[model samples]
Target: MNREIMTFDNVGLAYRRSLNPFSEKNWVLKDISFQLYRGEVLGVIGRNGAGKSTLLRLLAGIIAPNQGSISKERGIRSQLLTLNLGFIHKLSGFDNAIMSLVTQGKTIKEAHELVAGVIDFSGIGHLMDHSVSTYSAGERARLGFAIAMQATPDILLLDEMLGVGDKEFKVKSGKALKERVQSDQTAVLVSHSPTTIRKFCERVLWIEEGAVKALGPADTVLDEYEETAPTRGNSPSKTTTATAA
Candidate 1:
């Protein structure tokens, strides 16, 4: 019997304001709990300041929960949550790839080999020698995804990284991601776009006010979220924000 791949038990996160040490802690997330089984793609969605990114950080073990605990069975590969995650702007793309692999605990030789493949896969063969700082946002995203996919983690966590490339690249990357998910790689995608979520995720976790507001099949949850979500026609100002506190 295969055990669950990841579990969040009564997880909660709170931060103390620097100005007022004696003041009550500002709770960012509370009473969060969920289990992600192997080969499942979970979509995390929420309003602005709802702690969607915070939840992903906790799941990645980047930060410890303030109250409960998060557990992972093993073999989880976390990808670049943001542009600054894996590469240094001054470094070459090839160098950044190697550095990312080394950070993930690969040997120097292994990192070198993996970097070669990743650079090739990125279709930025000529640009590999250039400094990463010179690359555009789309190019950087490609490099990050290539490095992450090369590691072949059992679980992949992506945060609004799908639309970073050109249409052709997006098509190619989408196909690649689909193939990976088909091959027993569980995924967690956090995005504000409904179209993107419907394209890849089978399950959706709608978060609001730092808590899970709803959880179930992707279409169902997305429908409910859309209905409840503030729209431009009804609320123009709300559109500017991704999540609400």
Candidate 2:
């Protein structure tokens, strides 16, 4: 039996400069290869503009690779979850949940049945009755997240998308994902939170400048990243790492 849930084979993704076609393509990710195993939470760590989000989109099959291919077992359901976007803004939160779950292959009846659980976890309270457009940014994020939790895909692609509600919700959401991974559901998580990765991930992959920098045990990968990564405070981003050398 193949234990791998997804295999990325020398994958590369690039986008052409719209203004200058003859110019070199802006490569977002390059020569990426990895095997995601069943029931594993593979944490991805990288600095800003490191193509972490691009990698998640590739894994979710939302975009095609410019080179090579990503192979997965036939019929495995995969979905991307991100707090930055989701839900129909004009629709009520309840309507958005129903639409999302139905689009994920659930029947209307089935989706309606799952509404209670979504509401309970979303913690949006009575605000769910209003149009999502009327919600605060954080409220929108919470609603989107609640709808996503109704379906448990075979492969969950998380792009730095931990819950954006109150501190308590963030804690509970993190624990919920850990539970899902423990139950033999696979996931790829991209997060800046080293503590979250340290607590939940079995392994880690670090990407830098569109390429793999490291991939291994969580502690080892995270340790190497922190040691080499440039300071993130008042200093310029690339200044510390390169100038110090």
TM-scores for every predicted model: 0.87, 0.89
For candidate 2, write residues 107-216 as lDDT tens digits.
Answer: 98999999898899888869878888888877776666666677777888877667466788788787777778667878888899888789878688878888777788
lDDT of each: 0.78, 0.78
lDDT of candidate 1 vs native?
0.78
Please give the TM-score that candidate 1 achieves against the real structure.
0.87
User: Where does candidate 2 clash, by residue pair?
Assistant: none
The superposed Cα distance between candidate 2 and the true structure at residue 90, in angstroms, equals 1.6
Candidate 1 segments whose C-alpha is farther than 4 A from its true place: 74-77, 231-245
Residue 119 of model 1: what lDDT?
75
- How many clashes does the backbone of model 1 have? 5
